[model samples]
Target: MSLGFAYAAGFVLATSTGMLTLLGSGEFPPWLWLALFAPSATAVMRARNRQAPGWLGTLIGGGALIYGTLVVQSQGASGVLIGSTSGLLGIFIARLVTRTTLKHDLQALMLSLLIVIAGAGMNSGVSYGISFVAYAVSVVWALVTRQLVEGAEREASLPFGATLEVTLARRDIVTPVFFAASAMVSLVVLLSTSFLFVLFPRVGLGSFKMAQNSGLPDSVSLRGSPMAGGSGAVVARVKGVSGTQIDRGLYLRAATYDRMTRDAFVRDSELVGLQRSEWARLAHHEDARQYDVFLQPVTDGHLLVLG
Candidate 1:
């Protein structure tokens, strides 16, 4: 029973991490909440011996994978979302196969790991970071409990209550000393990997161009009739002004075009490169002023900046 509780707690923590990551993306649909909660809900039902047929589980898993692939192809769904859905489907199938076995626990662990991977891709917020740490600790507890449960089941044909009671009393497995050692080991591994990552060299290699192409266009033509009209729709809103304002015109610049032809203005292809330090120096000049801006959704993905 203690082992089961640990497993349940770990599963919930890991699942919450995934959900928080998706929430951070700010693009997850409300309808997808059902998908997020389905596996846990099904697990609860199965716990009451209301297990669905194996074939039905297989069908659901296979169909979900197919549907996820189709969604990716048609709607250009995020890689993280696709991977998460795949992992969820795997868990669904595993849950149907066996709930009380070590194999099932391991399967759930792997799926939870997959969800964490997806979460890393989806968001890098502080909340996600905290949730990830919680998940790591929970996983350690889960793994320890799984080992204990499996060992006890193998050693005795006694009732589950007796086996679990014996297992819980084992000092080697359940002692504070063991948990502390495990935690320290996990911490060492984490810090070592992070240190290596910080020391690694980064290569940008035009990845920003790929990002520009994937979601929205990087540039939009401002040399059209839309620029000449005062009756256009509002693109952005500014707030937090307290004092009385004068009736001066406000100008927001997105990009500058150097060459103006008869029909349109074309952007210059020549690029000027600067080092990070140089940019930082330029930004901190005494004549410079800073403003914070909030933006609404723009169809063309062109951000309006001010000089």
Candidate 2:
């Protein structure tokens, strides 16, 4: 994919995720959403063309589908289709409007942002009654002025990995000396700023504003997926009370359901009530027994290695 379209798709994912949190029923926390976005976008960006990879499609499309299902599963196909379509449309439009042959990375990034804002604004649901429209418009206009209206012939930005391949033999000798001096000056300035920031007195302006409260959010990191050809084995190992060893498998969690509207899970409730606690207690009892049978020096990564 072109850099412009790649960036545009990333922007759409971010925007859709944010909007879902803001306007939908249940919620996935921002941090988890960010984690999800990273791999999902990377998969989409790096996916081989000709025939798009199933893993890429599953990660990105499945995520959006899950979000849609959470929002309105009960609302039937209409609700699911609308939410899913909205996300898919954002990507489709981004790919359609971007030029494929842009050379510069910075320029491509700027152009991608421009495309996102322009495309987003065209969506009445996104732009309507939003105070940030002016900001979006100004950003778009500035890029057009710089890259298009101004007629700058700057080289299209190259991806970092590809840029590293340039041979030093191509360098002009005088340019090296000039660049060295510039680098020294830049290093000194950076050190001075760092010193000042560290030594500067920190003060809090006495103004405190409460953030708007929202729903409980959770996410599964892209570390593993049992449905995606995984071994579904234990992620961690454990030691037991006796001379026994217990692998981190054989335990399963019940599915969690979020508050549904239309076709998606819009809000997730905090686990509460006697029924919830009872379920938790029962699970705890089972885990306690499992943990008591593992051996020493069990390597479980960062997963909950229960004692």
* TM-score of every model versus the real structure: 0.52, 0.24
lDDT string for model 2 (156-257, tens) is 243432231132112332243543453465456645765666565242211222452333445422222333124544443434433222122233222223
Who wins the lDDT comparison? 1
As a TM-score, model 2 comes out at 0.24
For candidate 1, lDDT tens digit of each residue in 131-174? Answer: 67766766776677667667777766655445655664455545
- Residue 109 in model 1: shift from native, Å? 1.1
Candidate 2 stretches greater than 4 Å from native? 1-58, 62-73, 77-82, 89-128, 131-135, 138-307
